[model samples]
Target: MALRTGPAHAENDPATPSQRQIYSQSIAEHYDYRFGANQPFLPSLATTDTGEFINSKAFPTAKYCGHCHQEAHAEWRQSAHANSFRTPWYTRNVNLLMAEKGIEYARHCEGCHNPTALVSGAMTKGSTINRKFDEDGVTCSVCHAIQKVDTRGTGSYVLAQPAVLVDEHDQPIYGEVSDKEILTHLDRHSKAVMKDFYRTSEYCSACHKAALPRQLNDYKWQRAIFLYDEWQLSSFAKQSPLPFYTKDSVSTCQTCHMAREPLGAIPDYGAKDGKLASHRWLGANTIMAKFYNYDVQMEKTVAFLKNNVFNVDIFGLEKNGSRMIAPLGTEPVSIAPGDILTASIVIQNKGIAHSHVPEQRDMYESWVEFEVTDSTGRVLTHSGTIEPNGDLDPRAHSFTNRLVNIKGEINDLHQVWNNRVVAYNNTISSGRSQIVRYQFKVPTDARGPITVTAKVNYRRFDQHFMDFAMGKDHYPMPVVDMSSRTRTFSLGENPATPPDPQDNPLWMRWNNYGIAMLDAQQYSESVHAFEQVARLRPDYPDAFTNIAIANFSWQRYDDSRTSLTRALKLSPHNARALYYLALVERNQGNLDAAIADLREVIAQFPRSRDAHRELGFSFYQQRKYNEARAEYETLQTIDPDDLAAHYILSIVYRRLGMADKASHEAAMFADQKDDPTASTYALDFLRKHPEVASESVVWHTHSDLEAAPSHGSNAPAQ
Candidate 1:
């Protein structure tokens, strides 16, 4: 096929009996923007600047690019990107959305999944356009043609016109040229498609992040999956002090997903120094790869899942009737058959740059499977097991989300149109740890020795959803064990866990326990745990910082300051220490000192949400309205759903005599506010299932045991 100079010829044009652009018409009518089709690409479909549809024939196919970029093409062929649109699984999801709520609603999905179809008007009403591009599914041109990126997600890329060359007037030249002609204008070709931003995380954010808008669901704005923003605020971006594993530089999306690999013999046009960025965007899509029999990709995806992105550590046990904040596996211990215990497991999001199984928490299965057994092979108790019908044990501790509709119904399906609020979320953010306390009786008559096992597991999709999408012929979706730990309880006496090669250093293990204790609000135990970290790693600064965090949270401001001083003595420029020091100063009523330390912290990390939030509150306390407004405005851009910013900004607006702005901000504050009734939803579930509730009280914490989840428990400075 030659290079296309214009729109491809219409293929079997279909006539519509009714001229009504909606249900009376075709899919083309689905594209719209109730908020006006210009800003925030979700509703806009990210069409060309003029908001005009380009014909499908305008863009070249992957095969044309594969002729030269063979290695890259081959790698991409097995990737989730290539199968984004055409896969039977994806087709079923979008097809239903189109049917249930008019085709226009599906534009929310097709914008990211099948941009070629979207920008080319293939998704709208009775349209005659070359549909061949649909097979390419996020083809080579879709990424390379990106001219600009709007990091605020939901298909936020700006695409340039399709062209292989440009005229002297800087106009796009769309016709295909022969290899000999392209070799003569290789520089022009690079200029035509390649962009520096393509190598950036922001570029990935264009499609990776998503949100629900009023235009689609007839509701207020609500965030959907926000992998990009989540990463930006994690240790990966070096933008916060929340991480346990700290680094000096920002690790972009390409750093992990599109790892560079040797191209071997194939000539890859995009190769740099004997390596090309692997196009097999390794993700949690083992199901799709197996369905398509792309074994190599499937294997790689599984390997990625098990490649130490997260770790599961069965730390300790809490004897029932005698509650102890997981003191960790330190020193020898004793256990008896008649005793009931609560097993403590710590799940650390160690190396992942974003949340584990990010962006698909609502669909993917990620959970902690806990089991206990006796020497006689008698099953004591198991929380996470597959039922005969393929459903997971409903009470399993899962690292997933539950987005609810206005009526409080759970939308397990990936229906973007139905999302209203995050009713439940337990996904561990990067460099964070989650604690799962499972309590069970030891069985008085059971065998002496008890073996306990816990694992972090991943499945591409649950049985129910897969069955719904695939219909009668249910294809098997394999489960991947991401991380696991096993411990044994002896007859009368049990030694601490024997050191393992895979375990974190003893000091770090103690620190992990301390972090978990802080999350559970066991301040004395948390402080004791951090003190152990200090004793083991006296040279490490974070040990002291950890102690300070516990003290600060416990309201021992003087003791907190003492630890911070020691931490600073070890590392003068420790940002985490300095950030915590600021918190102490603010708590002690030293506003000026607190402001200085916060300013210094902000200088090192301009994107620090905590710094901006605290600074804004400080200024508001000093009654410096202008300065406070600037900080709050900056905070709003960093985290749009911040409750404090919305509430305080509403007051700031009124103080500035902007009554209209104040009134509007008040509504956002209410909208973004956490649903007090959401607590009742979990209570209702517990009431219905007293059997599960009787095990023990469960505490689910999101922060890395930070003193404050976001802002400190202290209300924003009056």
Candidate 2:
């Protein structure tokens, strides 16, 4: 298959002179007011002092910087960031946005993908852009000159003037003058450009962590991507004094992606240094590189994908027992004829900062291919195979999220503007694992030995998506094998003695069973398992907490109270236990108690958005409009796109006689409301569409281990 190679059609034309004049006039008119007034949503281009003019002598092209940094520049030239704006896929989508919403609306995308056009006042409808900057995409100076990162997230970086020195004519000087120049000169430039903030994950969050506001998507405020937040919760983001650090201490976004390489001597930077980091920013993006015929980058991306960041294992087998299903796997055991075999395949996200498949999940495909065969190599059962028509096996275990629009239909491709709900999300989180069980009946006349093979495969784009994106273009998107495991078992052997439940630490066995039950939503069974944990470890608060949660989920309010009481007795001020107790109280009509408990939770954890919303709702129920309005306003600050908050605020403001505010809130609520037919959980949707559910596994975070107690007696109770 030959890859398509050409400059994006959008880049072929420059902005018309009339459009440029209109943009220049608009910027001149709005610059001072927008920047000086501190309008939060406005771009940094509103500040005239930043000197973003491409024609300016101080602003050098990326090629100018490449003169001295040859190796880094060469590597970057092949990276996706280099071709970000010029890619055919990007141009196709962006042009569609322009045609549908006009150039003014298209600026939303240009803010990140074509910052140069945006900052130079060339992003208006019909305006021509600087071809040089558009091709550069995220250039070296664009990233290096970032002065500050806004905690608000979503491409909130402040651009400062470039660090390079200028000659008498104010033209920027590039590279070293000689082998030995004053260290201060280079140090000044480095200090201005490479601030310490650039080394942190927060720097990447500026663009990587994005969300669509209600105004932009014409839907409720939705978090479009969350790679940065995912990393923050993982072990990789921990610094000193934080307990979740990996064995090697702290690791930043730069650590794995821009790993240091030994480069030969380059003027003032030192000789043959291994501390020089590569600018390739290699990731799982081989498709775009292949489209552009960037062989070097394509090879590096493939290598990165297969670098053992994930592990797949056939952990155990399950069968019918006195218990609904008992785990049977310490070692390989015999399987008799007519017996049902339930094999559990565990896929662990080991090293990735976010979920195994991070951003643009709708475009990619990751699945577990499982096969079982006899000695003669005759296939017994096969899953995750691709059909000639490019459809995945209907019963395969796939790690992909199914996004649906307001009409409750699949988005199909990267039609992100139409997305309303994540119908199903099965991506495994960092340092987490998902267990998928496949059951098959052993044939009565089966051969002696049976072999099981499981492989985790990843493809850059799903076939349907590729076909839609590249019409009449036949490029083979390679399916890279991320991880695999094999296990063989013989028939006619005696069933091994089931491991004594007491042999291992009682907590471990019960905890495992409890978690498995929770994952399957077997609340009653999970409660029983957790009860065993509580009996074995009386002082452990987590087990009791788990019991309470199970009972709460099961809607046994009185029973939930009993377990929550015990959990609170073991550890006073347990946030989770208190939160659930409040839920039980609210459900049982103990509104005052619920309000008090929720307030306490908020006091302890001010960032608890749930607590604030619950308390706000409680106030609204009691007609305390002022208190409810205050709480909802705080929620708006915390999460501007909170659907429930906007809905309630509309009512609260109306009751308070603030007609304008109420009207504004009502408009936002209308835009953000969930589809009336949308199901809260994918499992609910799957219940009706069993065919699709059978092939996919949706791994929601299980809360059983949230408050798991420490082993030692001296350890503090959660």
Best-matching candidate per lDDT = 1
Tens digits of per-residue lDDT, candidate 2, 359-387, equal 54776778887777878776667667765
CA-lDDT, candidates in order: 0.73, 0.65
lDDT over C-alpha atoms for residue 456 of model 1: 87
Q: Residues 258-308, candidate 1, lDDT per residue (tens digit)?
A: 999887787987898899988999988878888888888888888888888
Q: Candidate 1: what lDDT?
A: 0.73
Query: Which of the numbered candidates is closest to the native, going by highest TM-score?
Result: 1
lDDT (0-100) at residue 400 of candidate 1?
72
Q: Model 1 — TM-score against the truth? A: 0.86
| lDDT (C-alpha) at residue 406 in model 2 | 55
lDDT of 2: 0.65
